[model samples]
Target: MEVKVKVWIEDDNRNLVFGSGKNEILKYVELTGSISKAATKAGMNYKKAWSHIQVLENYIEDKLVITKKGRGEDSGSKLTPKAKELIELYNQLDEDIKKYSQKRFEELFLKKDELISLKEDDAS
Candidate 1:
């Protein structure tokens, strides 16, 4: 068997502000410095990626990315300090949850051999 985990944050109004997909977009944008490039890397369209960022910003009531326009080479998106902090916190939370879930899953479900042996003993 396998285990999967997903984590996200919601605003006071219960609107989702951050999650795996958005996190990937944010990380990629930070790495590539361009929303368009990040969206391409993430297999999403520019519009969708921009929409996601906008939703997150609205939910959090903060601007997570600084956008620059024009055809200059320096034109690109950059993550705000708030965005960086949020990404770091979200990543840490994701790691902790994955570790906890894996440990619990092993304890509860990965002992099939032991369970089978116990069943055989009971049958005997």
Candidate 2:
């Protein structure tokens, strides 16, 4: 009765780049300005979050985060301009794809007009 869609990007070699998980982690980092905090909010540990960022960077061949080494509150992380752009573009494309997919699904499976034209063969 409903559709679930997930959008992700992969490199030319099929390496994972960006997806919902990365999106969430990056958004959290953008919001809290700390990978540690972002990891916590995303329900993962700091190491896992850091590893994801590293993987993303490897596939994209760009640094997505800026880290300042300092003590306590002074230490924080921020996203690069490219990272922000990636997030925006990814989100837009994902929304568009999901919308189109849903519309197609309804047209294919739930359209009343089509149902009216269904022949006996369609029942099988």
Q: Which candidate ranks first by TM-score, i.e. highest?
A: 2
Off by over 4 Å in 1: 11-14, 112-124
Number of backbone clashes in candidate 1: 0
Candidate 2 lands at a TM-score of 0.82
Candidate 2 at 64: error in angstroms?
0.8
TM-score of each: 0.81, 0.82
Q: What's the number of clashes in each of the models? A: 0, 0
Residues 1-124, candidate 2, lDDT per residue (tens digit)? Answer: 5567888888788877789889889999999999999999999999999999999888779999999988777578989999999889989999999999988877776766454334687667
Model 1 gets an lDDT of 0.88
Summed over model 2, clashes come to 0
Q: How much does each candidate deviate from the true structure in C-alpha RMSD?
A: 4.0, 3.5
lDDT of 1 by residue, 79-115 (tens): 9998899899999999999999988877876675453
